[model samples]
Target chain A: MKFFRNLTIGQYVHKDSPIHKLDPRIKILTSLLMMILIFLTESWWSFLIIGFFFTVNIWLSKVQIKYVLRGLKPILVLIILTLFIHLFTTPGEVIFQIGVIRMTWEGLSRGMFIAVRLFLLILTTSWLTLTTSPIALTDGIERLLSFFKIIGFPAHEIAMMMTIALRFIPTLMEETEKIIKAQMSRGADFESGNILKRMKNMIPIIIPLFINAFHRADELAIAMEARCYRGGEGRTHYRALSFKYLDKVFFMIISFTIALIIIINVV
Target chain B: MFIYLENASYTYNLNMPFETKALDSINLSIDRGEFIGIIGHTGCGKTTLLQLLNGLLEPTIGHVFIDGVDIHQNKKGLKEIRKKIGLTFQYPENQLFEESIYKEIAFGPRNLGITDDLLDERVKKAMKMVELDYNQYKDRSPFELSGGEMRRVAIASVLAIDPEIIILDEPTASLDPQSHASFLTLIKNLYQKYHKTMILVSHNMDVIAELAQRVLVMEKGKIIMDSTPRNIFQESVEQLEKIGLELPQVTYVMHRLKQMGKEVNSGVLTIEEAKEEIFSILKVKKSNNEIF
Candidate 1:
C-alpha cells in the first residue's frame, strides 16, 4: 500500500480555462477573502449565496467534477459522525426521545448548517489547489509577504522553503514506498496485529525513512550550493508575473460577491 | 520451486483516477538454484514485477505462491514468505538507517528470530560474502562508508536472511567501472557458492550475459521474450533494439565483425572471448598466407 494518501493536496490540474489562466496572486487573494467571509458570516441564506459562488468558480476552473468529489471522500465519514452526534445529543425543545436520547429541530438545523459549512469550505479550497500550480502559489506568497521584508521577516527564505518542500513531496513519497518494500522484504509486517504491535513494526520503516530524508537533504544542499544558489539573492524568474485585464475583472467580481453576501447577511 | 506468479496482474492506484496497469497477466515460475535476469527499458514494469516476487505487493488478479503456498491467502504468515525471498532494491544503499554496520546487516536475521550465536554467525557470513571485513566495519556507521561500501552493506543486510531466492534490482547502478565489475563478480560467486535462486533486474547487458542463464525481456508491461542469454542476444537482437535495449559493447563489435565478412562468432559476449577469437582467426590466416 502507498504511504502517502492520494489526497491531491497542492495538486494542479492543468487546464486552459479562464480561471486557470488568471494570475495566481489574484486567485490567492480572492480565495482568502472568500474564506474569511465564509467564517465571518453566520446567516444560512448568505451561505447559500457563497455556495453558489464556489460552484460557479469550480465550473470556471474546468477541472473534472469527479476529481473534486474524490478529494471530499475522506471527510464524508467525519461529517456524518459530526451531524449524528450534534443531532442526537443537543438538548433543546426535544421533538423526539429514544431511550435517554433527545432530538430537537434546532439541533438538527444547526448540525445541517455545520455540515454544509464544512462541505463548502473543503470544496472551495480544493478548487483553489486544482486551478493554481504550486510554483505560482509560492510566488504569490512570496510577493505578498514582501511587505514584511521591512520588519526582517525573511519572506524569501520562507517561500524558498515552501517551494522546496512542495517539490520534494512526490520524491519523498516514492522513497517511502521503496523503503517500505525494502522493510517488507525483510519480514517487517506493518499491516496486521494490534495498535501497539503495528506501531512497533513501524520503527524499522520510520527509521529508514528519516535517514533517507536526511541523506537527500544533504545531497540537495550540496547540489544547490554547487549551482551557486544563495538565498534567492539577485535572482530573476523565468516567468514574470504580469497582471492582465481578466485578473482585475475576476478580482472585482469576487469582491462584489463577498460584499453582496455580507450585505445580505447584515440586512 | 522457490517462487511462482500465476497469471498475476497488478494495477497501481487501483480503481482510482490515477490507476495504471503496471503488470498484465504475467505467469512465471522461478525454480530454486536457478539464476534469472530481467531487462527492460524505463517504466517497463520491471520494478513492479520484482516487488511481486517477494510479496511486498500482492497481485490484483491472481495468486503468488512461494514454496507452493498462496501468500495472500494467509496474511498473518506472509512474513515468512518475505523471509524466504530477499529483495534488494535499486539504489538500496539510500535506506541505510542503523547506527552501526553490524546492526544493519543483523536487521534481517534478527527479524527472522535468529539470536545470539546464530545471529552473529549470519551477520559475519553476510559481511564476508560482500567482502566487508567484520572487525574493521562492524562497528562503523553505515552512513560514513563510501558509496560502494554502503551499497555492499545494503546487499549484506539482505544476505543476512540467507533467503532461498535473492532478487537484486540494478545492484550495480551508479557505480564506477571497477566497483561494478567487483559487484558482478560477487553476485556470480554468490550464485555459484550458495546455489540460491536469483532474480537479477538490470539494464546492463554485460552483467546479465555473465550472470544469468535465462533472461526475460520486458517491454511496456508485457514479457516479450524468455530464453537463454546466448539465444536472446544472438537471435533477438533486432527485437531488443526495437525495444530500446542496446547490446553489450563486445557483442556489438562481434556482430560488426561478422557483418564485415570476418568469421567471428556472433555469440561472443565478453571482451576476453572476442580477443581470443580474433587472435586465433588471425593466426590461422597468417599460416595460410605463408603457405600460399
Candidate 2:
C-alpha cells in the first residue's frame, strides 16, 4: 500500500558534500565506467576494489545508507531471482543436491558474485541520483549526448524528455498516492486481490493517472510553446555546466579504481 | 472527544536529508456531529491533518483515536475507521476512472463488502444526495461529464460508503461562481440531511464562516486558534490577519465599521447579518435624534 512512498528515482537529497559538488557529467561518466568494470569483473578481489570505491563514493555523498538502500528494496526480488538462476543453471562440481536442484561450489560463488554486482550497481546509480539534482543530471546528459549530434540524434530533446519524466516522478507519485487514498476511503481494497483482480482494481488509478498525465503534458506543451521553447536549438542555459578542480580529482579516483579493477581481472 | 488527537505529529521523509515536519504536536477533539472548519494558508498541514484523520498517514509521534480506540494500533479496526471517515481530496474529479458513473460511485461501498443488491441502492441513493440524476448519468462515462459534474460524481463515490464522518479538503476550489455556490449548498444539505460529522478544510473564510459551527485555524503545523466561528472571527481579526488569513468579507466590513467609530457588531458573518447590524445601529441613532 505504501510502496511508492519509498521511491528513490529522481529524488535528489540536497547536500553541500563533495560528491554533490562534483560535476554531474563526471559523476555520470564515472558511474558508467564503474558499471562497465563491475560487469567485466571476474575475481572476488576486483569486486572488493569496486566495492571499496562504491562505499567511499556513498560516504562522500553524505546520504544515509538506509535511504540509499531503500531504493534497492524494489529490486530485491530481481537480485534474489538472479542469484537462484545462477546457482542452479551453471554447470560445475556439485557440492549439494536436493531433489531436482543441485548446487555446485562454482555456481554458489558465481551466484554470490552476481548478487553482489547487482547490489553494487543499484547502489551506485541511486547515489548518482541522490547526490545530483535533476536539472544538473539533465544538463549533464544533454552535454554528454551533444557529441552524438553529428550522427543526428536529437540529443537535447531526448535529454529534455528524460528531465521532464524525472521531474514528474515525484508529482505523479503524489498524485497516485492521493488517488489510492481517495479510493481507499470509499472501501477500495487494492491490497487483497488475485493477480487479475489486482490488475482490474488498478484501472481506477491507472486511467485517471494517464488522463491527468496527458492533461499535464498538454498544458506543459502549451506553456512551453508560449514561453518560446524551441527544443534546445539556440537555447542558452541559465546555469552553465563547468567542471571545477574537484571534478578532476573525482575523475582521477574513479580512473584509479578502474585501473585496479583491470589489474585484478588480469592477475 | 469523539474524535481525538493526542499530541499527534507527522513528518515526511523521516531521517532523510529533505525531511519535513508537516504536522507538529497537534492536539484537538471533535464531537460526533460537529461541523468543524479547518483554515490555513497553503502548506500549513491542513490536508495532512485530514489524511491522518482517516488513517491514510500514520503519525510520526502520538496517537489518533476514533471513538476511544487508537486507529494505528489495530489493522482490522483501522480499515473500519477508514470506511467511516470518508475524505474527498482536493481536485477530486481527477480520481475518477470508472467507465460508467454507476460503477465509479459503487467502487467505495463495494470495497466495504456491501452486497451487490445493496450497492445499486446505495449508489443511486448517494447520487441523489449529490443532486445527480442516477438514472440519467449512471451508465454515462464519468469523463464525459463537465468539471462540476465530475466533482459531484467523485463526492458521490465517497458518500456511497455511508461514512459517518466526511472530510473535504478544498472542495469548492477551482470551481466557477455558480458551481461553487451550488457545490457548497450540496455539501451543506448533505451534512444537514445525514447529520454526518463534517470536517471542511478551506482557505475561503466566507465559506467556512457560513458553514462551520466551529473553526480551527492552523499555522506552521499547529492549531493556533480553535473556537466557534463567531468567537474566532469576531475577536481575532488582527491575529488571523497576522497569520496571513483574512476575515469573511462581511466580517471585514464590520471590522472596518467598528474602526470608523460606528457601533457595529463585529461577530456578523454574512452580508445579511451585516445589514441587520447596521440597520439596528441606524435605528438607535435616529431614535436618539442623531443628525445624518
Candidate 3:
C-alpha cells in the first residue's frame, strides 16, 4: 500500500541541463528519428553506436543512468519472456537441445537484436519525456500537429487531452491509495483473498475512485468554462516556442548522426 | 490498556531515495472507552497513527496491541481486531458505492459475516445512531444525498460494525456550521451513551476542547504533549503557539484578561467556561461597589 505513493513512472525531471534547455519541438522530432533508426538497426555495430548516443543524451540531460533504467523495470519481464520464446521457437543452427527444446544460433541472435531494439526504444522515448515538461511537450505536439490542420486535425483538443491526462496521473494515484486505506480500515481484505474475491473487494475502492474522478472532471470543466477558455482558435501560448542557435547546433548534430547511420545501413 | 502502541514507527518507501520517517517511535497507551483527541499540522503523522492502530499498516519498528494481543501476529486475529476498531476517513462518503444507503452501511458488518436478520438489525441500528430515519433514507442512493447526509451515511457504515473503538480523521473538516454543530453532538452522544472509545484526529482546537477527554499534540512525527484538554490549552499556549498550533479561541480571551492587569485565571477552554469566569469577576465588582 505504501508502494502506491512511490509508483512514479517516467515523468519530467526538472533541471537546467542542455537537453532541457533545447527546443522541445527539436527534441520530439529527433526522438521520432531515433525510433526510425532503432527499427532499422539489425547489427551490433548500429546498436553500439545508438547506445552511445543515448548515453550522451542522458548525460547531457543531467539524469542519472539508474533513474532512466528504473523505467525499464515494468517491461523487463516482457523483454525476458520474448527472449525466451525466441530462444525456443525460432528455427536455426542448434546451439543445444534440452529435451526437444532446440536452442538455435539464429534465434539467439534475433532475440538479442529484438531485446536491444525494445530497450533502446524505451530509453529514447523516456529520454525525451524526462527532459521536457508536459506543458512544453503539449505545446510542441500542438505546433507540430498544427501543420496537419489542412487534414482536419483537432490539434488543440488532442493537446489539451494529453496535458490533462499527464497532469492527473499523480493525483489519481494518491486518491487510489487513500480509497484503499479507507476500505481496509473497514476490514475489507484486499490482500489474502483469491483472485475473484480480491477483485470483488476492489469494487469498494474502484467505485469511490471513479465517483471522485468524475466529480473532479466536472469541476475542472466548470472551472475552465468559468475562465472563458475557448478552443485553440486564435489562442496564443504563454511560452512561444522559438528555434535558437543552440537548437540549430543540436539539430544539425542529430541530423548528421542519423544520416550517417542511414547511409551505413543502406550500403 | 485496551489499545497500546509500543515504540511504533513507520518509514515509507524504505531503502529508496525518497524514503520518509512518518512516525518516530511513538509509545502510547489508551484505555477502553477513552475519548482521545490527536492534533497536529497536516503532515504530522496523525492519520498514519490512526492507520497503524487499526492494522491497516504494520509498524516498521514496534507493536500495536488490542486487548493484550498483538493484532499483527495472525491474520484471523487482525480481522477480529478490525471488528473491534472501526475507522472512518475524512470525506468517507467517497467510499460509498452501494445503490442504497442500507447496503452502504451494511457493507462493513456484512463483511464480518453478519447477514440476514442480524445484518438488517445492524443496518437499522447504525442509521438510527446517525439520526437518519431508517425507512425514509434506507432505499435512497447514497450518491443522491446532500453532502452532510452522505457523511452521516458514511459514519453509519463504520458504526454498523459495532466496534468498541472508533477512530475518525478530521470527521468535520468541510461541513457547514449547522452540520458541524450537530455532528459534534452526535459524536458526544455516541461516546456517552454507547461507551465507544473515540479517537478523533482534528486540527480544530475548540472541537477537541469540547469533546476530547485527553489531547495528544504531535509535531515532526512525535507525540510531544499528552494531557487533559484544559491543561494542554492553559499550560502549553506559548509552546503550541511557537509550533504554529492554534489554541482554543477562548483560551486567548482569558489570557488577554490576565495580561490586562485583571486577576483572571487564564486557562478557560469553552465559551461557557469563559462566560462563567467573566460573570464571577463582574459580580464581585458590583458587591464591592455596594459596600463602598
Best by DockQ: 3
Error of 1 at B109 (Å): 1.5
Q: What is the Cα-based lDDT of residue A110 in candidate 3?
A: 88
Cα RMSDs of all predictions? 2.8, 3.9, 2.3
Which residue runs does candidate 2 get wrong by more than 4 Å? A1-3, A11-133, A242-267, B15-18, B115-117, B284-292
Query: Of models 1 and 3, which has the larger TM-score?
Result: 3
Q: For candidate 2, write residues B130-183 as lDDT tens digits.
A: 999878999999999999999999999999988888899999999999999998
Model 1: residues >4 Å from true position, as ranges? Answer: A1-7, A76-92, A97-101, A265-267, B259-261, B285-292
Chain A TM-score by candidate, in order: 0.92, 0.85, 0.93
In candidate 3, position A136 carries an lDDT of 93
Cα lDDT for residue B68, candidate 3 = 91
Native-referenced DockQ of model 1 = 0.58
For all candidates in order, the CA lDDT equals: 0.87, 0.88, 0.89
Q: List TM-scores of chain B, every candidate.
A: 0.97, 0.95, 0.98
Q: What is the lDDT of residue B209 in candidate 3?
A: 95
